[model samples]
Target: MMSEEKSALTQTERTFGRRQIQAGHALMMLISRAIPHPIGEVWAAVTDPDRLEQYVGRPEGDLRRGGTYELPDGTRGDILRCDPPRMLTLSVQRPGGHSAELELHLTAEDSRTRIDLKYASVRKGFVLIDAASGEWAAGPGWEFFLDSLSDFLNGENPEEPLGIIGWRTFEGEQLGLYQARNAEWEKVKADWDHEHEATPGPS
Candidate 1:
């Protein structure tokens, strides 16, 4: 699991073992994080379109069950479930792929909140994302947004990213973060994912 920091964890308890998936079983991702914010604040940060746009993307939808949502980068989904300041589920479809079932769970404390995110798909190959960031290739994407949420809670609204791929791409281009991130990704996949390539998983 990714802790408070956006950086990766060396070892994470996983639900899927290292193995190649054919056409039957889907790859899955599960992660949990604790944020130092109230449940209401945390919920708004993730579900509120405007606030969500501050990190993920601009969303246009009623945000109710069965409502459709399209993120800024063309990623689309249906709101499968929405529970105030607590839980949410989405049928997310990436830019050029089939839909995946996504779930989010939250619990609140007096001054903090915990979130568990899950994503699963049988039709989509999570290779790219997995190659990009091992666990988050299909994740709640806290690494990309946790800091943004922190910024929002602190009232320092950011002007870039929020859900715009171009903005993040520009930053990676400008700061060379992509090269570093990809380099590390390559190493991680080689050390970890490579073993699963030829080993067929449950079909």
Candidate 2:
């Protein structure tokens, strides 16, 4: 089990991510982390169904490109692209007929594997309350999952289902970690907005 201080440090380090506006009203969120594992091991941990169930929910259905899959929690999505040991993209459907895109790209950084995740969603008046809060929700959500992935890679067994709020640590509930990460995302969005304001063009 990881100490509370160590877990907090891990969350802080993974909190750094970026938010950007894509074509028109679409928004893109990106987060990347380098795990101290080789590409093959990291790739397998993310793509293998049995391994995935350890941290993320167990996936059901064909995982290959163009196949549809459902998670144990009933979240369904279609695999848009799947390139072994490199990239995986999916179109995840949300409530109210809206959908989001998630893309994962992996690369070998020396002996470690760097995972880059991009999540994009089209802005619907009600779907996303606002850019800042929407990013606050999505950004830390991925950080929580990636942190779970790190825990799994380090041989720590997960005790409960993964989620953004009320995440558990060795000590107990660590909602503070989630809140801190949310703060980071808010800052990222603010910084991006400031930079765009200064430059005056689409970002």
Candidate 3:
């Protein structure tokens, strides 16, 4: 299933990137979501290494300016910048050494806090269309993350994965492409339903 999803996403990405085949630019935007936790609590959740692992990806070692972190699979990267309870910029060591800056801005409203995450992917040249389409394709991941983070911060787990599935198969015929995408969506939705059933309910 994973292989199939990956293949579909690759094809969709190729179609999405055809225009930017030469030089694809980076993506930048601010995404905001409300967390049930208080501002101070949310602040700690992002700054504290132990707390961060529960919501975001796990941390490798101490989290501070100039510190390094690794993904669960041991993909390592450095903490380019760290601002207490607020902003964080990391240099991800990927195939092309892509740099990503994650900033968490906290603001208090009523009894809850609004966390604004600005994700900036730094690449060369112009890639707005590709970036926008990729974002639309990857919407499920962000949606899952927001939902899971809300549960985690409120002292619970949704018991679900945070990711997306994009399907695409083009046969040089527009109608064929549409039908293929529709079929793929059905398969993806069914798979997601199965995964959700296997997962335990919220606490």
Candidate 4:
């Protein structure tokens, strides 16, 4: 059962929802993970700028509902909703007129906390299939962040805090972990695709 337990530790769920937008079909990606920490602690780690700097990049600006924030990487966004230690929603404005909505929901699971992240965006001139299949970058990227968050919570320092972009910077055991996680994600994606293909779509 050791293998099963290991799989449980890295378990993640991804779903895509389609909706019509002015440009075309909009896709929403939802990813969830369970962290072995209290809800309050997880909330602080995700929302507080100081703690966020440990795993995610440090963001600057008024971090509250109706305020604006800018990441170190030059990405800017507005804080659409902030429910404090529970939910946060943002409208991310990227370059080239690209925009996206991100939502984070935290639920308490006994002594652990469950984090649900939703990312929705509309491709200006792309079809649903085009946007859906290229999810390798987004999916594995978020998984890395969540994994880094878990490491930080457990008092472990991550060698690469920037996730997939800095893949080549990691070495030895850290590099091995990143490669292993990528392989795991590939298996998860394959299984998800197979099951969905056999199932019926919404009527």
Candidate 5:
């Protein structure tokens, strides 16, 4: 499964070199960026609920593994893994909604910090049409939040939470490429699925 699922995608298909790949029926979204700040400083800004509320959303919890947190929109999660200033994992879900996995990893790079963000749907089966839709969701959404986080790190105004509409325009411009990629991804996914003799998972 692992061997055949390696993404045959180019950097051009990625956002800031972020790779989106098919894992069974799952789509693993990966985004990474280097921020100009110490790892601890970067970690603190991200982990602190108050600091986060300034940019993204409200979160309240002890923030340790086994801890539970409430998001501003009432989405909640339990910390599945937590290694402060290094890595954190959570099983997230909304009220009466399907669950998802969110993970954050931090590393030091000279005087700056590198962060990788991943969001994976737990049970929802994924395909290219959905992935194109996801690009419109996770890509611009994270870009907006990261931009806000950057501003907060520099003691600047943490901008408002930008929505998915901006990427709607992006989707319009990339419609042709997205459609082609969707078709290619669908074929690759179908081939991989048949090769593995696996049942399709739930969406």
Candidate 6:
């Protein structure tokens, strides 16, 4: 009887694990920072196309249900639903027959606002065969996208490809930042090399 119970537990765990992966590797994090502005101000920062372009990917949809969004290089998607200043649901359909759902939620806090972002991939293995796959992170794209969004909200440009391939290619300001960052890394590498030379290895 005990052995049977163990088997049942294992099966339950496996089921949960599979469900999580199907949800595109679940991740939840909270970021709290003073926006130095009101909730509506931050809301406008995200929903207004002209304002958003300053800090995020250019959007080309009406931002309503049954609307569409054109990403950089002409990649596009339809808006599944949206509730202004509160939530948005998007259906990002890729060329490789993979689609995903992006859920964005915003909540107002006194003098500040909190944004919750969630991404669920409706189609699995889309990255392995899609051209636009490079536009997102290998493991999950939500983190990278949110990081960029935060930086933009703070009035800063993203560091690289602006997405998944940011680390793969360097351009203009990206190249400059890359070079600077690598130069600092090289210094650390040299120090490590010197330390290694002074230490003894396994015999």
What are the per-residue Cα lDDT tens digits for candidate 2 across 1-203? 99774565453332222333322345677787788989999889888988988777788998788898887655678998899999998887654455677888999989988898887777443121244434326777777778888889899967765732232332235556666666667777777667656555687
What would the per-residue lDDT of candidate 3 be over residues 1-203, giving only the tens digit for each residue? 56644443333211111111112444444446666677777777666656656655566765668887776534456776776655666654433354544455678887787766554454532112133433322222333345456767778843322222222322354324334444444455455446646667799
TM-score of 2: 0.76
Error of 1 at 158 (Å): 2.4
User: For residues 27-128, what per-residue lDDT tens digits would candidate 1 score against the true structure?
Assistant: 655556677888888888788777776666778876777789887777787887887878898877776666567777889866988776666677544523
- For candidate 2, the 10 contiguous residues with the lowest summed lDDT are 14-23
lDDT, candidates in the order shown: 0.60, 0.69, 0.49, 0.70, 0.61, 0.50
lDDT of each residue in 1-203, candidate 4, tens digit only: 55733574358876655544334566666778888899999888888888877777788998888899987766688998889788998887755466777788999999999999877778532212133443324555566678788888899865544622454555786556555655565565566557667666799
lDDT, candidate 1, at 159: 65
Superpose all Cα atoms of candidate 4 onto the true structure and report the RMSD in Å to 1 decimal.
Answer: 5.4
* TM-scores for every predicted model: 0.66, 0.76, 0.53, 0.72, 0.62, 0.55
* Candidate 3 residue pairs that clash: none
Clashes of each: 6, 0, 0, 0, 0, 1
Candidate numbers sorted by lDDT from highest down: 4, 2, 5, 1, 6, 3
Error of 4 at 154 (Å): 1.2
lDDT of 5: 0.61
Q: Give the Å error, residue 92, model 4.
A: 1.9
Residue 160 miss distance in model 5 (angstroms): 3.8
TM-score of 5: 0.62
Error of 3 at 25 (Å): 7.2
Candidate with the larger lDDT of 3 and 5:
5
Error of 2 at 25 (Å): 5.3
Shift of residue 122 alpha carbon in model 3, Å: 3.8
Better of 2 and 3 by lDDT: 2
